[model samples]
Target: MNVPSNRPWPRAAWLTLAGVVVLFFIYWSTVASTVAIWRRSETFAHGFLIFPISAWLIWQRRREIAALTPVPDWRGLILLAVLGLAWLAAEVARVLVIQQLALVAMVPALVFTLLGWRITWAMAFPLAFLLLAVPMGEFLIPPMMEFTADFTVAALRLTGIPVYREGTFFTIPSGNWSVVEGCSGLRYLIASFTLGTLYGYLTYRSLKKRLLFALASIVVPIIANGLRAYMIVMIAHLSDMRLALGVDHYIYGWVFFGVVMLLLFWIGSFWREDERVKPAPPVVEYGWGLPGGLKPMLAASLIIAGFWPAYAAYVEGLAPNNLAVRLQAPAGRNGWRLVAPVTDWRPEYKGMDASLHQTYGKDGRVVGVFLAYYRYQRQDAELINSQNVMVRQKHPVWSNVGEAAQVVELAGRPVTVIETRLRSPHQRLLVWHWNWLNGPFTVNPYWAKFYEARARLLGHWDDAAAIIVYTPYEERPENAARTLQDFLRDMLPALTAKLEQAAET
Candidate 1:
């Protein structure tokens, strides 16, 4: 049979070139957003797995793709454009990068299709790997929470602690230690899975081992977090919530998770066999030396590099800003009275001033708590101590719950508020930072300090003070008052309990 001159060179050569470029571009666009989102939450951080996992899958197919001929099909640009538009629009909408991460996988598919590579059964794994970056783990939260809560409660009970758990939270009889949303293992679960998947893909050469490790990644975090919660509860029970360290639980969870994963990998290696094969040497047929026309491409690359910094700045400016402070209440309204003032006692911090209060409705139902502190500027440990007190107020101490804080800066300096509300039948904790009304600054250092203080508090939610820095606005006194009143109404119980806890501690 005569081969037609019109037919392009063998398929193997083309696919390899196309796949590499497609993979690079898929990762290139997401790099900035990925880093940003990862900084914010575990859900986003785990998204870093997409690249390496995809690379692993691609490596598996290198032999097959290497047999294909190079063919740059322009049709892929249309698919790329559509996907790019979707991602760009989502980014513009201020959607988290993890939400649009699925779009990253489309580039490779579009390239493969354009280059005439048939979609085969073998392509499924790589395609699946691509979707891992998307913020798809939320659906697993309820299940993860349920498991963690169950184990935590069981462990607490086994340790001779009187415990009552419902749904995602539990109550310890000795002190007000409530297992709440922030403690529900959602963040830890996501972080664990993310780390697990990446480690599994990178370390394991066997598919079975990789998949098993991935499963372990998902399961281990939940178990470890449960253990962390159990430990916290056990300590709280032993010492009347004395061990209710606010952020320290998170650190302990991570450490426990690390230990668990190490054990899992050790066990996995005993049964798993390595399956990677060394590649054969490349065969050169037609002589090709940069095609003697690399200048245009090189020039284009250089031009891109030169403008990239400015382009990055422009992109950042376009990125949606979420950390801005927006007060939703009116100030200057003094008619509001504390119906559930929780402040009975003050906890002692070596160098920090702490105050806590709980407000309630006239009906005596718990509203929320107001915990505040003033640590001399740059004195981080005191600031954190204040916040940990607030976090402990929402759990077993009070049946109501949610996360506890929103971070904003007063002026430009870092400040935080521990907010809790009984909007409906549930409690809500919002963590907010109040910047020192001056300029741009970083809160990470303060957060680290806060974590350290919580660890020292040693599982005592009450021993620490709930911290909220109110940013008073001269122009909106009415709004501020209304906001204060509203917040008071919501968090009265938490505040009162925190103050009381402090006194007892």
Candidate 2:
């Protein structure tokens, strides 16, 4: 690669660099958070390479970029402002994914604003590729896990092996297997998509071929993962659970994926169209100095980009000082009396300002109630968080086998709750949970975050709580569900009143 250092730096290049530096400093926290995730999560570790790859892509186009002249476009400021507001909204809601996306988006907006459309267009791919750095797609885990389980179980049955499945957990005669987060193939999908897109970009100049290859990259990994899972199970079954049950399980998966990827690339190679390099076009000669009115546009763009973080900080400062919070248990009524918790299962909720756990008994049935209350919610301490779940994947004492949204009557009105089923070696439970944001009940995390952001932005109390109700069952889960509904029918009004009183206090 020939370096171009003979000519002076273009004014647009200088301005764009300055804008990017400003953006980095203004959203340093978001940048740091993204890097932290990349470091910690094996699934998102690919993020570390995204920047360098994008830079390389840009470097490849340096000759073409040098041939064009840049003119600042004022319209970029409008995009900057929109993205800034979006970042602020994500900040207020404490949605890390959105915050990261908004921050990444501002880079292209800055380039566009400072370099105009033609120059921005010249570097569009590199700019757009930066978005792959964001650590997202966690929402796909459940569905992917479901598909893996379905495929593996169906394959086992077809092979004349009897299998029993419940949610992502399943049992074969040799041993038991559960498709936890590790088996969801999310890492595979992300890796394949990233590499495949990069491969398509490099190998095929045609848009149709590039898109088709990218689509194949996504589809192949998913199907390959399903096939990989089936083979792993087969190995375990054939070996009497001697192999592919522990460390080798992951090893086998990666080895299989490597083979599949190689096979895919080989197949795709037949249709590859290599770009023929041409001599660089002569660089356009223009005044090295900044254009008139460009300075004002740059200033305005920086102001628009910088305003969001400032407003976010101000809004954050408005959060009230943490106050001492105490929650009283709902009084038992209608023959249901408060008693010691019958089981040791508890929902995994952290950073709560207050928490209450109580068990109620009527006749032979026992029901448990748990509340994780929060006031002045903020990052790492909010009620709606991925960390707050029914059961951690690696928990030794429990496993979450199934969960879904369920609608049930509460205080004479139907309300949706997250219905979770947990299983242990000796116990089984059915749980119903929802977030109590101010006074409204919501099972959707997005809605809960929206309500929290609305309350905080409007200068109201950002009070929220995670409410969970559960009951133990031996065989019939429907019986346990009935027990919970009956208990809630009689106990919800008092529980609501107690929460209201706590909020008032």
Highest-scoring model, lDDT = 2
Candidates in order have lDDT scores of 0.47, 0.86
Clash count for candidate 1 is 91
Candidate 1, after superposition: displacement of residue 7 in Å? 11
User: CA shift at 363, candidate 2, in angstroms?
Assistant: 2.8
Give candidate 1's TM-score: 0.46
- lDDT accuracy of residue 12 in candidate 1: 33
Candidate 2 lDDT trough over 10 residues, lowest sum = 1-10
lDDT per residue as tens, model 2, 194-287? 9899999888988899999999999999998999999999998898888887799999999999998999899999999988776664454222
Error of 2 at 99 (Å): 0.9
Error (Å) of candidate 2 at residue 441 is 1.0
Candidate 1 per-residue lDDT over residues 1-505, each given as its tens digit: 1111122444433543554464445446555555666677655665666667676777767676555433333344445545554444333223334225635555454444333333322355566666666654554554565677778778877877787654455667775444555666777666666666656755776778788888887777777777887776676567655554767656666677678777876776676555566554333222111222223223322233234333333454532232222211222122434453433322223344444433433332223333443322122334432333322334323332333444433333334543333212332222233211111222443443344333322322212333342312234334443554455444433443434444443
Misplaced by over 4 Å in model 2 are: 1-9, 276-291
